[model samples]
Target: MQAAISFAISLVAMSFGIAKLPLGPWERGFLALGLIFVVTSSFTLAKCVRDRQEVTEVSSRVDKARLDKLLAEHDPFETKNL
Candidate 1:
């Protein structure tokens, strides 16, 4: 929540700053487009990183479960027929 609020504040501040720039409309439009691109790219990167971490966590859990199942079925004192 805090991070979201901060992002919103920053975005608004940047927009206002860009609007106040002395540059012409075309340049301001370009800068706004660039800012939007950067924001979207950052979101995409963040989502990718989060998805990767989640996948890793899920795989680790599956591996742990497999190890536990194997251990549960293991016996130390079982007799073996040769």
Candidate 2:
């Protein structure tokens, strides 16, 4: 799924062009640079999002384990002596 989405985004960026318009050498270079920047940024942003999600999941698991440990050791109502 991620691969499909990445391909689609890159395809759209590559489709951009001064096709019929008369552009100088420098103008063409800048346009190409802009396209590259957009593609790179999209990939970078996706990675950051994935990294954050993984971190959140790990943190949640750790929290649950801590809670479980505390509950196991807790002695509510102090019913140890009869």
Candidate 3:
């Protein structure tokens, strides 16, 4: 969702550069904002991919059945001896 917004803003600003075919204050501002949006979005995308890879790596090291048993033992409905 954030990536989409950033891309859209960047595209709109770039359109001004292409349509006007002249460099001016507003056009320059738009160009700068567009570049910022692209860079920020790219960084965000890279972070998301990196985090996902880390999670995949960690999950692969765990034993699924043991994990499930631990989850079941911690159930809120389970009675505990005080």
Choose the strongest candidate by TM-score. 1
Candidate closer to the true structure by lDDT (higher is better), 1 or 3: 1
Task: State the RMSD for candidate 3.
Answer: 8.1
RMSD (Å) per prediction: 0.8, 3.3, 8.1
Off by over 4 Å in 1: none
lDDT against the true structure, each candidate: 0.98, 0.82, 0.78
lDDT of 2 by residue, 1-82 (tens): 9989989876665655444337887888787787778878988999999999999999999999999999998989777665
Predicted candidate 1 versus true structure: per-residue lDDT over 1-82, tens digit per residue: 9999999999999999999999999999999999999999999999999999999999999999999999999998999999
TM-score of each: 0.95, 0.69, 0.51
> Per-residue lDDT tens digits of candidate 3, residues 12-60?
7766655676677787777777776877898899999999999987787
Q: Which pairs of residues collide in model 1?
A: none
lDDT of 3 at 49: 100
lDDT of 3 at 53: 97
Model 1 — which ten-residue stretch has the worst lDDT? 71-80
Candidate 2: count the clashes: 0
Model 1 quality (TM-score): 0.95
Best by lDDT: 1
